[model samples]
Target: MLSRRSVAVATMFLGIIYLAFISLGIPDSLLGSAWPVIRPDMGASFGFAGILSMVVAGGTIVSSLVSGSLVQRLGTGKITLISCCLTAGALLGFSMAPSIFWLVLLAIPLGLGGGAIDAALNHYVAENYKAHHMNWLHCFWGVGATLGPIIMSFYMVKHNSWRDGYTAVSMIQFTLAIVLLVTLPLWKRIAVSREHERLDSMIPQDQVGPELKQPAISSKANVLQIKGVKQTLIAFLFYCGVESTVGLWGTSYLVGARNMTAETAAGWISLYYGGITMGRLITGFITLKINNRVLIRCGQIIAIAGGGMLLLPLPQLFLVGLILIGLGLAPIYPGLLHETPTRFGRDNSAKLMGYQMAVAYTGTTFLPPLFGLLAAQTTIHAFPFIVIAFIILMMMSAEKVNHILNNQTKSTGINC
Candidate 1:
């Protein structure tokens, strides 16, 4: 059993992790929410916003691909601290950006910083905490994502300046960076205590349960060679595609196709993210009763229905559909991530996490821009079709992963 001190330390560390996740999400929606005004101010085309988003996503892909090595060397705490600083500096740069060129350049560090913190915190939580904590951790991300548009809209409405919004968020990021610096040692303390607990829980091989008898997968083995790995990665890619496309273009779609004001569109988009926040908050409790697989399937179905709703002409349905998509997506990412150790192996989870993140960002990098091109050619009304297609692809890939994992478990006599 953990001593009271150890439990306190662990709780405190988790609280910090939650805050870090909030910081991680704070800047995500800023570009999207501000793009309507930003494009005109800079005399840029509507599709050009995708270029900036693509740059950010590209940088994220690079960082995520290398995050495993970085975490191994610098550890999660230092990585998170450094990432926070990088992101803060980038956001500050964003505030001063005079043109789309500068915004694209600033997006690079923004993406790099975000990917590192995301992978690091996700792996840490999945390794150390319960399924509920994973949900709640991501719930905090939703909080930040939800707050992001609200913050931007506030500044845009009150100050008529998106730069001021970026500046305000940058200040928040810098503050979190300082907090992370002070709490750096707590990570080690919690890690050591958890290690001690794990060691103490070890038992003789003869007494080990059947579930524990499976040999560890070698970390050196190519993770892509694993039976379900490719499918899981594909699922991740499409899942992120669906989410990022919406985030990057949802406001634009509202303004262009739906005839909504930029300020009103920003509010509606915030509601979409708010749905994610509220859904994840509720999902944390639901996880106590439902397994990850069930939650994931349910989320997908709801997302599909939400996408279908978007096809309707009624504005009321559009509002409901947006919220439904957010609620549907709330559980899927966290569920898949938390299940990594089980579907693969604990030894492989760390490396696989990085790969998964890289692929996810790859989707983020390319899909929205591709859609932007398509929208430029046709109309923003194409948005719902893209969202629906991505969700279907994600669902198929996820189910294939499940099938592959189940087969492997049956053949190898290892419980996943």
Candidate 2:
């Protein structure tokens, strides 16, 4: 059992972590909404959006690759607090930026901050927190993600200034940074608790069960040697691609294929995001009873069913497909991460999680653009078909992960 102080510290730390996740998301959707206003004002073409996005993705990929070593050195709290500062600073730059050159330059720090904090917190929580909190944490990010666009929309219509929206959200991040700094002691307490557990674990071999953990996996090279790592990475990659492609292109598909008005398509896409948020909310509770693998597989099966609806060419059924797709996509991200500690040892999962994140963001960066080109060259009608192809790839990769893990577990004679 945890001491009273330890439990209290854990509670406070968990709350801070959730708030950090929300901050992580604030800038993610902000640019998308504000782009309409930001573009013309800076005398930039629409193609500049892709250039800026790639810059951010490049920064994220670099940061995520190095997150394991950084976390080992500085710890999650320091890294997260500093990351918040970086992003908040970038947002301020966005507010004051006089040209597209400044905006593009600021995106580097924005991506670096976002990636570091994301990988650090994910591995920390996956090792330390419960299944429900993991799922709920992502839901909180959805809250920030949703809030970003809303803030932009408000400033656009009310004040006729998108810059003000960036300023306002920057204040929120600054506030969160202060809270993190004040609660820095909580991370120290968590560190102490972890050290004590490690010492206790060193007490005897029999008491702690099998010595299955490989500490050398703390490095990226060794972590890749862990069973199912590559397959899991592939699964995450395709999963993120499927989710992004669908979410980004679903509005267009609705417009071109279903003949819906732009306004109606926008509303339904909003509902699709709502479906994701709501589904994660529900998933947090359901995970209490169901197995993790079962939850993941069930989520994919349901998503496949939703994808089937899209392929049917039925009118008004596309809305149902959108919601179903959102609900089905909900649990997979967190659920996959939740299984990491068990599939690989706790120490190894830390590195693997970072790599998983890097690969996932890579998918977010590249695959959607590929589909965009394909859709442009052929027809927008191919959007759903492309999404479904990615969905199938994700499923097959997941199956490979399961197969590898199951065989490894059997060979070791341990339950996973």
Clashing pairs in 2: none
* C-alpha TM-score for every candidate: 0.86, 0.92
Give the Å shift of residue 326 in candidate 1. Answer: 2.3
- What is the C-alpha lDDT profile of model 2 across 191-257, one tens digit per residue? 6786676567564323433323212223335788876788888999999998888878888888988
Residue-level lDDT tens digits of model 1 in 80-132: 99999999999999899988888888889999999888988888888777788
lDDT of each: 0.87, 0.84
What TM-score does candidate 2 get on C-alpha atoms? 0.92
Minimal lDDT window, size 10, model 1 = 209-218
What's the CA error at residue 188 for candidate 1, in Å? 2.4
